[model samples]
Target: MKIFSNPNISKVMKIYEKSKKHTSEGVKETDYSKDKLELSNNAKELQIALKAYKNLPEIREEKVKEIKDRIQQGSYNVAGKEIAEKILQGVQIDKKI
Candidate 1:
């Protein structure tokens, strides 16, 4: 049997050959380098500042001692209006959330 004698078979064979050639031509050899990270001067300074900030004490002991002394002297007074305002502000923030 002569398969090429059939016009449809010949057309399909030509398409298969062309597809093989196109696919072979499309083959690419790629070379990849390892990814790198480079920090700017500002970034380096920020990292150092962050490290120092993290090393700092969370609470101010000197301020706490001064406040304690004032409270002992019966002079550490907070206004009622200020306390009410803070409470109201907290309530408004809670409502927003």
Candidate 2:
């Protein structure tokens, strides 16, 4: 009668069905000539952008040096426009939004 009392019998049945399927059909191995990777159409662009962003040493190192210099000077103010732009682009959000 309680919520947890039944303990997801349907889920248990699903697991049992999958086990039977695995026994009948056996398991298939994946081809790893390309790391066996797949991404959703929505996320595929994000993956590419992330890879490109990581390749930007100047963008990364300049910000690092900017922070270090600001720390030594006892003042730090970030120029966040570029980062905000990148994040917006990554998420495919329009600048007008």
Candidate 3:
């Protein structure tokens, strides 16, 4: 069965085709060659900091080796107070969030 053979469907299809033709004729070519982007001061600072961080070593092998050596010699000392302070700081940050 042909749906467009119905009077209502045929009328709607004719209107849709006419609208598409009119819209296509009315569209003008757009030029994007003059586009410009300006970053805020904070964004510029973040870009600079990101670049510096990218240039840094991903892992501090020297520091890691020093800690490993200290641990092997039974001299690696971790202060309980420092650990407690860090935990408390994390909790405070979570609460703020």
Candidate 4:
């Protein structure tokens, strides 16, 4: 119960100083307007993505069985180059973003 007896004093003070520096650097109260705009944009983006996914193709149960059957029959082929090309395209697109 003595002052300065706690060894955590220096640790707490160091953390506090760091946080204070960050606040002085640029921290400000949250802006509801900008936050709401960003959230709405995110929701719109997610909805668009979901719609795109649904529109892409129906590659389920029947497709899975077909692929499995083909593979078991030793005729299942994969175009690795196409996959690599698509991946590279994605990377390029991300860089543009």
Q: Sorted by lDDT, highest first, which candidate order results?
A: 1, 3, 4, 2
Top candidate, metric TM-score: 3
Worst 10 residues of 3 by lDDT: 25-34
**Candidate 1, residues 1-97: lDDT per residue as tens digits?**
9988999998999999999988877775445679999999999999999999999999999999999999999999999999999999999999999
List lDDT for all candidates, in order. Answer: 0.94, 0.78, 0.93, 0.85
Model 1: residues with Cα > 4 Å off, grouped in runs: 1-28, 74-97
Candidate 4 displacement at residue 79 in angstroms: 3.0
lDDT of 4 by residue, 5-76 (tens): 787987898899999988876746544454343458889999999999988767678889999999999999
lDDT of 2 by residue, 3-91 (tens): 53576976787799999988776545543465577779879889899999888775668788888998999897656998898887977
Off by over 4 Å in 3: 1-35, 91-97
Better of 3 and 4 by TM-score: 3
Model 2 alpha-carbon drift over 4 Å, by segment: 1-47, 77-97
Model 3 earns a TM-score of 0.52
lDDT of 1: 0.94
Question: How many residue-pair clashes does candidate 1 contain?
Answer: 0
Q: Which candidate is the best by lDDT?
A: 1
The better candidate by TM-score, 2 or 3, is 3
